[model samples]
Structures are given as structure tokens and as C-alpha cells.
Target: MPYTRPARPPPEEASLQGSELAHEIVDVLVDRQAEDVVLLDMTSLSVFADYFVIATVDNPRQARAVVDAVEAHVLADGRSRPKVEGAADSSWILVDLGEGIFVHVFTEDSRAFYNLEGLWNRAQEVVRVQ
Candidate 1:
């Protein structure tokens, strides 16, 4: 599937409202040794999503694992399952959690090419997980 940028949230709204769930998702990524976990504040950028979580996994297997972790975390927390994309190929998996969008398990080359951080330059860097 092509890369579709999600809708941005309102500027005045607080993206961190889902901080607890975000932390849980970040924890899962970190535990799996995902790289460069970045939280992008998309409040002023667009009106669709609040935050964007980006990270990289080493390989296909790890990609799937990361997706599983995110799915498990959100479901366990009583939140709905994110609208997942790109899981079959395990190259770039995007978990759309409504208020937040999580991009997991990308290869180094893919991550570098997409450069989500650079693309959303206007977004404030909320946190960086190792």
C-alpha cells in the first residue's frame, strides 16, 4: 500500500492525552530493540491524528513481532485495534490508533528513505526512546 499520511489533530488539543498508551507502545518497541523511537506532535500539522510514533526493526520477523506487541498493548488496554497497513510484507507496518499513528518495524534503508521526521519538520519532538 502507498504511504498515506493520516489526518492531523487540532492544534489546541493535547496529543499527550494518550501518553500512557504511547508509553506502552514505546516500551514494546524498545523491548524488541527497535531503533530511533520518535514521537512527532502532529497537532498543528494536520487535523487527523494527534501524534506519530516512528521506529525501526531489524528484519521481517522483528517487524511482525513489533506489530504484535502494539496490537496486544492497545487491545489489552481496552482500546480498539489500530488500522494496520504493510504487515504482510513486513517492511513498514503502520498502526493507526485514531488519536495516534504508530509506524513500526522498518528496515534501516526504508526508514532513512522515508525520513518521517524530516517530512513532519513542523511537528515538535515530544520524546525519543533510545
Candidate 2:
């Protein structure tokens, strides 16, 4: 499929600054068997963040597990706890590790609705974890 550009650049480059931390979070998700892991590079666009790490879990249980793994890993790495949002319903969870790594954990329906991959068409795709 063709790529699509985000409506606006990320609010800051903070997300891109902590890429290693982001990668660690991705690794944790993968380890937990998260599905459809994807990394979006938003460096070229005018935005606040530099990168977006998106992934999917099969269900609410997995969604929560993914977030837990991310939190634990980031903390273990000695980074500040990420500012997380959207966990109440567990359909879509956003973990903000200020600088340039924004993580999104979404359910199938939510993932389809947000279509982040489609929205960030212009951003470079770093990887797609099957």
C-alpha cells in the first residue's frame, strides 16, 4: 500500500531523541508477542516528535501486557517513566517518552480507525514486526 503523510508534524523532537529507549520498548513488546509492530520515522515532517512506534495486541489483555512490558523496560533502562495515556479502555494506549519516541498500542478496530500507518504515509517505515 502507498504511504500517507501525517496532518501535522509531531509537537516536538523529543520523541526522536530517545530512540534507543523506543527500540527497547519495541523489543519488550515483541518479547511479549505483540503483533504487527511498526516504527514510523517522522523526522522529515514539521512536528514535535521524530519517531512513532506503533504496535498491536490481539486483545485487551495483550494490550495491557504490552504497556506493562514497555513501562517496565523503560524504567529498567533508567529512563524516566513515560507519560502514558489511553489505558482506561485498553483499545489504544499511547506511551509518551518525551523527545521523539511515542508508542501506540492499539486493538484491531482502533488501529483500523486511527489508521496511523496510513496517516503517516510520508514518514519512513523503519520496520514492520510480524
Off by over 4 Å in 2: 1-17
lDDT (tens digit, per residue) of candidate 1 on 1-130: 8999767556434344566566667778888789889877676787776677888878877888888888887788776777888856667878888655655558778888888888888998888987
Candidate with maximal lDDT: 2
- The TM-score measured for candidate 2 stands at 0.82
* Candidate 1: regions farther than 4 A off: 1-16
Per-model TM-score on C-alpha atoms: 0.81, 0.82
Per-residue lDDT over 53-113 for candidate 2, one digit per residue giving the tens place of the 0 to 100 score: 8988888878888888888887887777889897556799998876567889999899999
